[model samples]
Target: MSRRNHTDKNASGDPRKRTGAPGVSAENGDGGYNAGIAVFSYIVGGIIVWSLIGWGLDYLWGTRWIVLVGALLGAAGGFYLSHMHGLTSSRNPAGGSGAASGPSEDGNSNAK
Candidate 1:
């Protein structure tokens, strides 16, 4: 008598296969942030940074509204650039979203 070997099969009768890992999509397997989120974050971050710089400059130069205007323009430009670059993932190192590198001279990231 001959014995038959049975293999696991899906409902469709195709051999069942296991995916390599979870949280990973077949597309863009880098495991980074979704393209939308990254672009939004970059745009927002750039705007905030540019605005802050403009505000500081205005304060130092005693110019009213000048810094605000410049900040607005800078923010707009930064947002456009970020969008163009498709700055998607702000997490995975492959996406270049890692934390700040090195230490500040004042021993604080927020040091002026």
Candidate 2:
């Protein structure tokens, strides 16, 4: 006598696959989106904070060029920090096994 092996199937008679989830696409799973956001925030925050400081100095010392210098310095520092972050993250693809992981302060999943 011959036997048959039965498999799980969908309503369409196709074998059921265990692919990921239903609606969640696998695109951008490499952390590029998060990195972009982080880098952008760094740049903006650096500019705002440093520019304010420069503006304050200008108000006190009565000079305009200092504000430009401060803005430039902020931009350079922001880019450098972003680059360092990229290096660290690349070194640990799994995003470090230590603390300060998981959902961020905004409650968004860090895995994204």
TM-score of each: 0.41, 0.51
Cα-based lDDT for every prediction? 0.57, 0.62
C-alpha lDDT of residue 87 in model 1 = 45
Candidate 2 lDDT over residue span 1-112, tens digit each: 9753343433355555422222223333334556667677777878888888899999999998878888888887778877765521444446676568656786655555
User: What RMSD does each model have against the real structure?
Assistant: 18.9, 19.0
lDDT by residue (16-106, candidate 1, tens digit) is 5422123334245343455455555655677677778888888898887866676677668766765445343243737544667777566
**Candidate 1 clash pair list:** 38-88
How well does candidate 2 score on lDDT at residue 62?
94
Tell me the lDDT of model 1 at 35: 48
Task: Please identify model 2 stretches exceeding 4 Å from their true place.
Answer: 1-29, 87-112
